[model samples]
Target: MNRQAQAVVLLLLGGAVIRACFTDLYLNYVKEGLRPFLIAAGVLLVAAAVMTLWYELRPVPRAAATGDGPGQPEARAGGHDDHDHHDHHDDHDHHDHHDGHGHHEPRVGWLLILPVLGLLLVAPPALGSYAAGQAGTALASQQQPSDYPPLPEGDPVRVSVLDYASRALFDKGASIGDRRVQVTGFITAGPDGQPILARMVLSCCAADGRPVKLGMTGNAPAGLADDTWVEVTGRYSDRIGRDAVNDAEIPYLDVESWRQVPAPKQPYE
Candidate 1:
């Protein structure tokens, strides 16, 4: 590829990497720990771009400056015979090195700008209920005995969906006791149009997200669409049973109160 094209590609790639790190759009695709790596990669790419630009812009030396002195035609011709011949051969090899072996400016290089545009113009949406349902749930680790701290004193203690699910499934609701807890999560429709409060837990990013859902009992809210974020105040129900679809014990909750709510900034747990 030409130096200009190479520089442009580096600029686009570097800009995209740096932009993703700064805006946290990277979190949609990768773990939080990857921030350092992204930053380093972006810096390297930008450095490479600057170097390429300098190389492309550097002044070319004039042939006259390196030519033989006046009144030395024979010497100049002899020198030209040796040096010009070598230069011609070297130029051919250089041309082959740069442009041969199917290394012509890759048409795919333009595609690098697409991701930058995607990040800057229209960022993609996070994974939603359809993805959760289609992918199903996968526990992060095998069931182990765990002792959870007592719920903080509150009429309706706020808790995370994963914490509640872990306590319910593994600890058998002992830690939860009879305390009423409130949790926020998006709603996923159950088999019979029932609302299942669900949260997606990620080991890295949305690609590896696994849904942690709790079935809600009591009065099912009317006109509750799928993927609607909600805050539900509820207690663990004694109606735990094996789910026929996934053949896993699905935790159920007795809903005391629920209302539609705005989605949180971080969609994943």
Candidate 2:
């Protein structure tokens, strides 16, 4: 690609990054902590692209404007003579052709625009049920069981899917007791086609995310499509099952009620 094309690509890419940083879209791919770094990197890329365009478009100085010495005419004449001689030799040599501008940038450089356009025009959605189904429940086995604080005073206290799973599996349901809690996550199908509540856990970005699933029993709704975001009110159960794909232990939630809800701004925990 030419320098102009490179500058355009860089400008689009930088703009896309800045736009994602300002919006909630960046949460789909990465952690909230990386926003400042992403914004700074985008600014640097934009600055570099602007500088490149300015340098390429700037006016060139003429030889006469430089006040060349009298001997310059003779030097120019000799240079033309050498050029004529080379042209004469090339007239008979079929393999001596040149494109004149001399730049040989790889054509593959244009491929960079694909990702730039993707980010600017149609950013990808966050990892959903398909991604969750491919992986097993992620429970921190190294975490020892302990007394967890009592649930806040609410008929159905709001809690994250990961926290509920950890308390149910690691704490052996002691912390959960008989209190009804509300959890929100997308639904994924289990081995027997039952709806499972799941959320992805990301240490850094979506690439390293793994699912934390809870088997929905009791009055849990049926026939909900995968990736349908919902709020479920339920109590912990002693029932546990193994993942069909990886045999990871999945805790159970005895759901009492459920309702479809819009997806959250931050999909991962």
Candidate 3:
């Protein structure tokens, strides 16, 4: 890649990162708090590209404007009769050494544009059922003893999958007794080939996301597809005896009602 190509690559990368940050696409791959750093990095890269362009466009000094050095006379229009021809040739060579060789051609630098194009054309999706399943059936948070405040005043209290699972597994569902709770998550196939309510929790980014699953037992909508987002209102039940599936119990929910819903902007909690 030449200096011009290098500058283009920098501009492309910087623009892509900045665009992702501005349009909230970065949330799919990283935490929202990284926006400032992404913007800073993009600004630096674009500034560097501008500097490269400036350097490439800068005017080169004319070697013929002044004599080569002390005791040397400028060459004539038709010939170098005013100065020694051999010394003039040497001086021209020295000037070429200083001005002819510009920035290095970037041979492998073109590969740097691939990531920028990828981010621009095809965005990376947020982690979904495939990633969750691959991470195994593990709760992102460990089961621990704690006092959970009373459920907010609502017929069907809205709670996250992680919160429900933590309460069910650790607190023995005491706080969940007879209270109809609503939880939202994508659907995943259970060990018994039944639909399971699943949600992924991320500490920082999708790379660290883990799944929290709850078995659904009720009138699931007809043809409920995998990864279909849904809001299920249900209460904890002891119908299945709560056996462990993948190192974690598939807390059963007696689904009272459910409906399809659009996937949340931030898929992970």
Identify the leading candidate in terms of TM-score.
Answer: 2
Clashes of 3: 1
Candidate 2, which segments miss by more than 4 Å at Cα? Answer: 64-102, 140-144
The lowest-lDDT stretch of 10 consecutive residues in candidate 2 is: 66-75
Model 1 lDDT per residue over 1-269, tens place? 57787787788778888998898777766767878998999999999999999888888665543454565345344456636855877898899898757657777767767776776678877777887676555543447568888889997999998888778887888999999999998888765566787888888767778787788888545577888999999888877744435656678888988988998767888
By summed lDDT, which 10 consecutive residues of candidate 3 come out lowest? 239-248
Sort by lDDT, best first: 2, 3, 1
TM-score of 3: 0.78
Q: Which stretches of candidate 1 lie over 4 Å from their true place?
A: 1-3, 31-34, 63-103, 241-245
TM-score of each: 0.77, 0.86, 0.78
Q: How close is candidate 1 to the true structure, as a TM-score?
A: 0.77
Score each candidate by Cα lDDT: 0.78, 0.86, 0.78
- Clashing residue pairs in candidate 1, if any? none
Error of 2 at 264 (Å): 0.8
Q: How far out, in Å, is residue 118 in model 1?
A: 1.8
Q: Write the per-residue lDDT of candidate 2 for residues 1-269, one digit (tens) a residue.
A: 99988998889889999999999789999999989999999999999899999988988666443434465533355466535655666774544346444456788999989999998888999999999888877774437557777778888899999889988888888988999999999999987888888999999999999999999889997888889999999898999988887887899999999999999989999
